[model samples]
Target: MLASRFGAAAVAIMCAASAPAFADDTLKKLGQFQSTGAPGEIPQVEQGGKKAENLRAIAPKIKVPDGFKVELYAIVPDARHMAVGTNVGVVFVGTRKTKAWAVTDRDGDDVADEVKEFAPSIKKSNPNGMCFTPDGFLYMAEHNRVLLFPAAEFFYESPDVAVEVIAEQLIPKAEESFNHGARACVVGPDDKLYIPLGQPFNVPPKDKLPLYDEQGMSGIIRMDRDGKNREVFALGVRNSVGLAFNPKNGELWFTDNQVDGMGDDIPPGELNRATKAGQNFGFPWYGGGMVRTKEYQGEQPPADAVKPEIEFAAHAADLGMRFYTGEQFPEKYRGGIFVAEHGSWNRKKPVGARIMFVTLKADGSADKAEVFADGWLDDKTGRYLGRPVDVAVALDGSLLVSDDLSGAIWRISYKD
Candidate 1:
């Protein structure tokens, strides 16, 4: 397919031609993605009854393409759409409501035991972005800063303390209307931290019909590992609560929440690929590649504005994303991306609440999208059995999902 698109010889030539620019652009996007502290992971969780915290039984019933099986990998308490990490073989996850971090060791044998907490509490702050670096140090992203603790101290409290503040004092003041407190961060290819500082509110235009640009308070920011070198990569983005580096192209991808109160199906949510730094993605000016309605008149972006890779249904509230790199799934999905739809609240009718896949083409556009897992939200009564927040690859080549609504972790694997 790639050869057909770019030609057999053109692949090499084009790669050579684009390599330098791609690398430079990739570095900029990486810094932009991690400018905050650490980006969070979303787990697509079931919304039914208050189920028991068991990783084994929760794995099944997840719908997937052929040749795939789902199972419970680990059970976590109050698991939000935050990040997770593994070292040697231990798996760790961060949470928000409980202000705690948990870990489980799932070796290649498909068994996860020794469930425990890595960090106790952060006191009045949300716990997100618990991940590892190319080095061995484990990192966690709180609301306004990133904290690092020794890996050995994960099992037991260690007297050897090495806590460093990578990023601090973010967005001292924001628009009074926005509800964006979910800032996620990750390390970029340049070894610097990229963090997302979200916008302030769900705004409307000045007068009413034909939406206009409502700028300020919402954008993707970049910073160094030590919290220096801060800059805005793109503006007008409402909020990218989750971010992930595309394993195939090394580009940064994010899920943006469309502004609400625009009806259930207008101005759908978006899955955006950050191809260049300082690229403006249509936010208040436009949504889902179409102009939206607003209360006040505003300036619209030029026709040259970058469009989204994929536009989800209105109010889907797409969040965390993970590129599938496991061996358990079929070959077709080996290099695809999985996104978690946390569902929406302000809409008259709720949408999302499932795990979906973005099938990428050689040109990097999403050719099509389909649900990898469903049964989360009910269409008949508008009730939800589960709410998916983030997706992650487990040690055994299975997929793990976190549910903030139910505070549970689910595992989906293949067995054929």
Candidate 2:
């Protein structure tokens, strides 16, 4: 029944729409059948309605520093990375699931007035990365392709907005893995589109090292807006899901989820900085800086393998991050980094499920890291109420955090 509906709906929509004929193949492949149903038909792991009501009941329990308050901004299923629309004040959210959402607040109220799917006509697989170029173009990086929606903020509600494939065949269709396939993208200060391609293994298999290194897998790559001049910008990273360019120095910063199965506390997750192009951050050779993995224990690390700027708690699962350039917060938060730790699944005692702040010194080096907001994980019950996946600063200077577990976006604001 699910496949029938999916296939019929897809065929009908394709026939009614003006999209290219090749989109049929893409939609068919994305609809690969499973025992449960079509992959796209799988209900979002987190949902709205009853789940959202429960989440709202716990919203007041969330903890933040003094003078700060947390409120439910919107209910968006499977919200991952977020990009705020420049002209329309719409917050665009990407997801590992089929749909991407655009959230809006038409009135002056901080809460959202409407949350709707963006570009329902387009078929996307693991469209987890979303960003807006400085010139206002919105780009979405999916598992195997990248898309550009020109003037997306203006025409998101329309069913016939133009969609261009900027890049495709990013990872070979045959080599696609169920794990670490969701990507993250950012428009860097250089005006290039930067994307991180995670190698598919806890520690990449030795047999695949050459192919991974040559193709910039397990690292970050950049290309022009037209998808030309593709080149490896950084290498030797392990499943980095977050990328942010500092507004002050334009350097790249990211969160690297370290290898698992090494006990709860052996290797730590990392928050790293890359000051220049072609630099490598140690991965298989040294898992999360200095903790050698058994797979590559005897191997030698690259001479220039850079270390992380700060080491987070092991199994924290640090994912999305951003540099705070907003003025709504206190003066002390200016130029600091806000990271979303999505929490842990395998640990005996789960950690993270909160936001962290990392302050930078005058010299542009990290000074300290501390929790900015928490209480998502109840200490008494050891269960998580929400898992934060991404952070974004709204145009009004408020901080927005996307929680995938609870299917909600939270607004963190400050008042004197």
Candidate that would win on lDDT: 2
TM-score of each: 0.78, 0.88
User: 214-251, model 2: which lDDT tens digit per residue?
Assistant: 77888999998768889989998999999999998999
C-alpha RMSD values across all candidates:
11.3, 7.4
Looking at model 2, report the run of 10 residues with the lowest lDDT sum.
35-44
In candidate 1 the C-alpha lDDT for residue 122 amounts to 29
Candidate 1 Cα errors over 4 Å, as ranges: 1-61, 106-111, 121-124, 150-161, 173-178, 204-216, 293-297
TM-score, prediction 1: 0.78
